[model samples]
Target: MSGERRRVMILAYFYPPLAGGGVHRVLSFTRHLPAHGWDCTVVCAGPDDSWIRDPSLLDRVPAGTEVLRVGGGSGLALLQRLRGARTSATRSSTTIGWLRRAVDWFAFPDSYAGWAARARAVAARRLARGDISVLLSSSPPDSSHLAARSLARRFGLPWVADFRDPWVGLHFRTPPTPWHRARHRAAERAVVAEAAVVLAASHTHERELQALRGRDGRPLARSVVWLPNGYEPANAAASADAESPPRSRDGGAPTASTESRFLLVFTGTLALMDSTFTALEALARFVRARPAARSQLQMVLAGPYESSYAQRVAALGLADLVRLTGSLAHDQARALQRKADVLLLWKPLGVGYRTMVPGKLYEYLDAGRPILALLPSDDEAARMVLDAGGTVVPPGDAAAVERALEAAFGSWLQGGRVPERRPAWLTGHARERLAAELAGTLETIVKGRR
Candidate 1:
């Protein structure tokens, strides 16, 4: 282990071929870790119906990196299958409601818990060879960390638990029942206590993790690191260069024309927590004030969205101006972002949101288009937007959003110029650079174990 390159077993339930923003961080790590004297073997869940699968993502994984795909029983898949059949007999029933609750209460942490036992068995065999240096587990399905904790304890390996999102204090998810809450809280504490280091995706998350204590009321882990999400510079640059259209004379907004409508693009899942409805309301207000601009404006939601969003657009009479493009591959989404006149981000209003930076934010910044972010003025995402030369308006304020859109529209009409992002700012957020920093942290933990 001393002379040979360090080997890390990365347990990420969400990995390549899974079409979502969550895969990028781990993908980048596996791509760049070898350059920094580390090699990665990824253990991830096999394809499931729960998410859109993007086989193209597998091409991005570095050559020589071993990826072990383990199949597991997905609670989400089962629930979706149950809900898929809505017979007339069952349409007005309370049974489906009760079953939904049961699934929520039992799926501790996430549906991927079934993957943990399989992953542990795979990890155990890998560790027995005495070649692996450390265990790294990233999560949203916090189950990955749970498995890593068990493996580390059994194998006496230093474990690094990475939290891409909060487990117990998640903002967007429904509050679990009291029993489920206690279970999540206890499980989170156990993982944190066992890991040698914990990596949080945001500063606020770091502070929250640092404050966590075990059941005995003692601090869980001695070290917690802040590792925010970032953009892959090479991919971003290439996509923008190859796919983006020429900017309008006024600004980086795409050239305005009858065919080239003022496009506002939003990528990713449009969940209840997203500010889609708010954006729609603002668009409605904008169109009402300037009815002539209706034909000129267009909003493209370029990822999976709830069916309710389509109904909302129709209800608000915005179907003419809005296009709901169901889930696209990661590369296609980025291409759409690069081609956009304005990129849209909606951070829901909440104190917890201050610590949450959507993974898309970095990509938005990298896209180098004018960003119209509906977020609190003091939120972490807002700060990043401002620093990257994007515009920010408070979340849930339709008037403010309307004003920002008007300003962007006016700038486009006036032949205004897009501001150049600070080179220093952009450099700091490159995925390779962040991965190097992560490598250094992993090195320290490995050395300390000696």
Candidate 2:
């Protein structure tokens, strides 16, 4: 079998060109997994202009790799249409909210459910092309798992299910009904049970997936790997100077004020699995009590944001202190991640959020920059940050966040921008190593079956 072609068919709904953890995870695997013995082929939903696209990432795909675009991506299009003309429509207030719910009721598994049959067909064709020894599916659009499950059952191919996020208590959106929620739970349980190997993004997620049993009450996947999100050592994380620095919507030289200005950078979405209210309030308090500090403050919300974020900033009287750069290209965002006095992060305050860690945390650690994070103290993410010598304040505790902010600001004022404390062990989170680990897991799985 080793003499036969060693290949993996990956059902990734959003691969390269689509910017996200799912894209980064699979892309890194495809790039480095080959050295560890598995070549790759990816099946993605053709194209949807609605989601953020970074054409830059397409360049990172390995020369001999194959990316197959399957269905016409009606999932995001339908999502855009159902939300009406308002791009900012919330789930509760959308004019077609009921219609959306009605549509979602039939959206068993996930929004990309429509792509399953098409994806299955494409996967069948690829499997027939020869010697694809293993099947892997990455999800958030959990529909990919559904497609892989079908192919696995039909062909008796050993499949690996990678859950970038939890399915049942998913962070993406609220499940429409109890039945829908139950359906997701059942689907997750089934995925864990059937996968030849299951990969969880973190230890907490590994526990969550393993906690579920099969439909017949059997234990889940024979193997589970704690494959946390990681950073690429070769990612060329050099900070690119912005074109004269990002400015506020109202317009002003961001660096003009103060004897000593400090930049707090956050380079990902505020809308998912995180909130900024605690961080925001802490900054507001830090500035109000020391009006002179306002002159030195600048925080960049450097990704997609809502209208209300600006309103909130204005309401807190720190509009001048905050800059929203909207969405940036992947390289641009990575540059921003490195060009900061201190990296700021917020995990949404709740028991649910503790089970997940943001993908950016490792990238931050890899950058060797100091971080000011607002997350639960006992969760896996906090422990990782603490290990790498970054600050973590308990979520929703504005006072604690403010204290951390002030401490970081003091470090910036003192001249080191916080003592460089990133540990040597963080190199373990490098994508190349993780890919090797994944390759070993896949090899073991293939051998066990023999």
Candidate 3:
């Protein structure tokens, strides 16, 4: 290219105005890459009502950044609607099962396979114009990597495939049949073999990718890098002021002393698979054992939860102690985190849970409050919290949680002053620094081509 600054075309299906934790990583990359002499152009899905839409996130995008919005309908939402219709029909169970299997087989990596064509076409047009110097694709709807692989091969460009979540070995989904599993493995191998570099969100994920071998029995990718998620300092600074006092829905300051009650806050999606039930049980146990403690403690769940979860909390007779604030915007959630006396982090109970770390961990640390993490001792999240001077208890250990709560409550009662010691490791994971590291890696790839 003629310009001194190299360009990277990012293919991400999840981008802002779609509100979720998944968009932050790519958004940060786009925001900071320019400072490191790497410009970015993002191609992502267009607005869809079926998904949670947060127009406020658009403000976070860097000015003058070119974004290509592709509209081909949301394949994932369409599949869910079809499944609902099939369930309502009088079709045989076997037939419905077969149809679901067919969809899974055809979709390959994810239901958003349909978006691959449009994304590739947009990237190809830019590449043909001598615009994009390198290709970077991030995924969960792994179809983005498939598109990147095809375009890279066609245009002879160096590609970096980033896996935010494991494709085949994901613990949340039911295991596929032998044939489907083999096909998924083959596709993963192909992407790894073709890409110049592979990026995994965790060290464990990097090790897994490094273990994959090509058809010639050689290591799959030329290099595999661990590109973990991080926190944005600006967002942290904006919400840090919330630590002053709790606010009402109308943004009114606390009428009573904020220290009158020990506030524990959890912010994120609440699902059956997560440790929500375990945390609630622990709270109930603690309250029931010492009824007076309930008067001085309150736990707020600042996210959407199933109706059954509320019912369960009521059944436990701890409804008065727990508040479920449906769903809040990203900034609002951070504000809540900042106001809390203790932030709660829970890892879902399942196989491979130890290898994964939730994106919220960084935000929790950035909040500068004490964290009570309910996760396995061996998990990466647990290690980070411990390193950052936070508390940790094994998942499902109500007794341990109760003890921790009791101690935290006692500390709150006596002055409520928790020392703020930002861990040294946190500086290494800052969004700007990580983006600079990535920029250097991309520069290395671009220079090699020259």
Give lDDT for model 2: 0.74
lDDT of 3: 0.76
TM-score of structure candidate 1: 0.88
**Candidate 3 residue-wise lDDT at 292:** 85
Least accurate 10 contiguous residues by lDDT in model 2: 86-95
Q: Which digits, one per residue and each the tens of the lDDT, describe model 3 over residues 1-450?
A: 235887899999888876566788999999999998888899998766134455667988998688998876456456545666311101233443455465675666666778878888987887898878899999867889999999999998899998877773333444467776777777878888888889888887788889887778888789998988888863545544333444432345443444567889888766543477777888998888888887788888766554556776798887778876654567877877877899999855776555577888888888788999998887778888999889999888888888998898888878775766568778788889999889888988888887
lDDT (0 to 1) per candidate? 0.76, 0.74, 0.76
Q: Name the weakest run of 10 consecutive residues (lDDT summed) in model 3.
A: 85-94
RMSD versus native structure for model 1: 5.5
Worst 10 residues of 1 by lDDT: 85-94
Clashes of 3: 0
